[model samples]
Target: MGLDSTPSRYRRIVEEHFTALYGSAFGRLGQVLAVDAAPDGRRAAVLGEIRSAWRDRPDAVLHLVDLDTGATTRLGDGGDVCPQWSPDGTRIAVATGGAARLVDPDTGAGTPAPPVPGVVEYLQWAPDGRQLLLGVHRPAATGGDAAPVVTGTGADEGARGLWIWDTATASVRQLTVTGAVWEASWCGADRIAAIVSDRPTENSWYTATLTLIEVAGGQRIGYRSDRQLALPTGAPDGSAVAFVECWCSDRGVVAGALKLLDPATGTVSDVDTRGVDVTDLRWPNSLWYAGIREPETAVGVVSGTGVDGDPARPAPASTEVAPAAGSRAGEEIWSGTDTIGQFYPAVAPLPGGRFVAVHSSYARPPELAVFDRAAEPRTVLAAGHDGEHRVRDRAGTLSYVDWSAPDGLRIGGFLARPAGTGPHPLVLHVHGGPVLAFRNRWQLGHPLIGLLVAHGYAVLSANPRGSTGRGREYVDRVVGDMGGADAGDLLAGVDAMIERGVTEPGRIGVTGHSYGGFMSCWLVGAHPGRFAAAVAASSVTDWYVQHFASEIGWFDVAFLGATPDTPGGPHFTRSPLSLAHRVRTPTLLFAGADDTGVPPVQSTEFATALAESGTPVEHVRYPNEGHVTRGQRAILDQHARTLDWFARHLPTG
Candidate 1:
């Protein structure tokens, strides 16, 4: 049963193994999307979706899990949005279609709230639970010879705005007459603070306004700023509001500040975060809880007792608290160590010194974990079962590794290797979201890593300079220099891996999707002799074409710092297609046929270029897919093609 002896049979065996492993892993960890802890923190309402079979689509459902007993009670079908737990913990509100529904966590009974005008985006319970803040979308007004215009601030595409649902009166009132409301929180019984944008563009973060509105009179007071403001959390006592303010350049948020705003006077003061990338702001009590992503992801807390200082006072000294052992008066509660990755781990402060969160690692699936001062994480809901154990038994071992780049910047990544000895054929897998990091979560998006390792290949997934786990400065490094330092950092990581004798020279391959796909194409072209083969899926080839065709075309200007038409700009010089003539490695390109993010034309154009340059290349476009393939058939076919492509180009013994 060697690689060359029975190619089809060998491939079939590999596919079957991968299918079983994927099914087991997928089932073991029910896809927990959002988790909201009860006010008391004794239990949590988990909104998740799971597919029993490959052909089946995931059905959304809510589960009430007892933290102490590990008892999970299914609460009817849920929507594809976050479920809000009432302030008093008596009811849970979820958006379903154009209306909001209230579900009794214990009884599983649902009460339909008053229907809104359009599709419901988000539902937030008022402080007293008498009203629900409904983010909904209304169709754009159209007339003769005019195209329908979509507007609004809802997460979905449309004309989105804010609406108030009065529970007692069973009435709905439009809060904002125009513009899209990004996020809102109740400041008091009669006032609400929200982030609103005049234009409903995808890049609203850079143009939104933070406003305090009187609910009854519709009197609005807003602060005007060019910086991006987000994740606004109102104080429990309604004295102040805190939000994340990001300094925006042509690129995205380069730096951020956790600022406190006085609702009465409209004066904003900085709450010192020591200049870290603070996100997921929550005001549970007198303390402000947020997740800090710089240095590494950890829970950060600051006292809000005196946050509403004098309006004319200079911003107080940095309130940033370092990771400490015990929870003192002003210390932050750091979760576990820096070695593990926690991607936006949700934290809910409990009555005592306890906190509950959904935690996961490279080797661990997400599970409900409770934390305390003892520094030990106790799992309340186990995400693994026999299926998970079976998959883990055959899975490769994962370890964290880091190396200094050419520019003295430290780069980090995770390496997964098979059990056997000697230098192994290596596959350098790149992650997308130039802003997103290669975290320690289960590699559901890149399951091919497991399949390749099972067949005797070392997989190296690196987080280069622009990744988010580091601070904003590190993330902003790739802004105007997308393919420069970041690409060098990746090459340096590969060199370090080979230097450590973990990978065989000249037997290396590369693959990635989205921005990662761009990297894949750039890697093979930039270092023509380095990799034996390349797979670039949903990749951007020419910045000019991508700018006009993609939904996030604005990203081109943000990242490249120039429009496509800019004369002799990096948009053309740094694009992978510019160096396509140098590519010697056999390449495989793929994309979703209907992808609006990185349109399939990206792959088509690159494939055409590679062919014209006499490079061995193959192109695949999955039909009815978007930026990423979703259907089970498409996923399976993609996996098989990828495995078979790698095996053919870089054969293993």
Candidate 2:
């Protein structure tokens, strides 16, 4: 049967795979992404999952998790994220596979309302809660699938437009026929604010001008902005919009100022808020934005007033902004110091102008704590599990440690020591995104790490040079260097892990997805004897071919620092094929057939090279997964096979 043909069988296969691979329940369950307060405020609209619910499943169904009783109700067939609670809070609007649906929160039943045939992303409920707005790429009838809007590529095969869908009537309208538009905010029932760019250039994030557009007339008035404006959040009064404006800075554009935009007057001023890039922004009476400036993570509150596109006066200075109660942006939030991992933090607004930040540590599961602003020295609502039995069955201490690279740059990583072991086999878990961070948050069904640990193996996840959370400089460290400094940092992390008594030196293995996959391939080739085995997933074997082959339009130039057509060529020295002769490790290569990001060719080319060199190698490809192996069953199976491969090659405790 096809992958999605039978959910029951798939779940069984995944469970069996998990048991065979992990041999322990480290409590690695699935994660919930979207949550909202119910109308009565007694319960919450939580869209999460149970691990076995859908094995080998690509996307998740919208499930309503009751806050009070922790009861869950599945909402739709599948393919959902970014669910929003209506203003009245009776219903919820969910952005699923390719459509927007309105579901009754109490019943968890939705009226099917599919979006136009295009990629619709970042959905928002209108102020009146009557309509939903989102960004979509509507391709021309003749054109094929929407090509990624890359940096230098001028081909606009799809028309990027603002789509407004009325939930009551299921009527949809194209607000703005602009391709470079991003992040729409509903000012009122008739007016909308969006970031638009006429002449788009390659930038890290969305770099566009804030524009106010009238839905009925298709009239557009550009809000004055010297730099790009993003994360546009409408005020409570629906009169003014507060957003972060990107300014050119010496230390890089990591810092941003809160600005009130006036569409009528075309005026934009720098408000009192000044800090790192705004990760999440919300307006609950006061304009609250979550900012992370590396060593210091703080939330700045701004207040202002304006309407009809008129500039407003700046708010008072933000004085007592602190970390999100239980959040540690630089250290605890991420799993390690050098590498970037995934983190799911709960930002729940509490009573009396406070917020409760709940998440888990690498060594622990989910935990909750309340943050009180009035208390002196900030009292802790809950210090979380006291490192007791919570981690007893866990492989090892999920400790955050740091090390210095050759250039004096501080690198971070997570060292998961084996449960009952002296010196265990070491496995380096390389992260994807190459730019994203790996934070210390709750993770469920982490097959690779959990299975390796259960098998008496020490796992190390490191954020080398290009990882985030440290600073903008650290994220862009591998921008121009790509494989150079990042590879060195990974190597250094392994060396440091061994010196720190985390694992044995001779029994080291490395594995990564996407960019991390490239590093794994590079590691096997660059330092031949350093690792006993390597697993490269959806990696980049040849940069020259990947510039046009990749799905993301801007990734090539943004990461490589040079376009494919540039004089010196595809920029950096990136070719797993060239280093194939040096790989002596028993290697395993993995990829998804449908991965548009790093296509299967990357894995195929490397596998071919290893086989041609007479090196021990194994290759496996999933039918429809994207860059990473994400289907519950697929991921479980991949994890089981990976652990088996590593165990057979690397020395076990």
By lDDT, the best candidate is 1
If scored against the real structure, what TM-score would every candidate get?
0.87, 0.77
Report lDDT (Cα) of residue 588, candidate 1.
90
lDDT of 2 by residue, 87-144 (tens): 7778888777766778887777777665575777668887667888877756534434
Go through the candidates in order and give each one's C-alpha lDDT: 0.70, 0.60
lDDT score for residue 93 of model 2:
80
Clashing pairs in 1: 151-158, 151-159, 151-160, 152-159, 152-160, 153-160, 153-180, 362-440
Worst 10 residues of 2 by lDDT: 331-340
Worst 10 residues of 1 by lDDT: 308-317
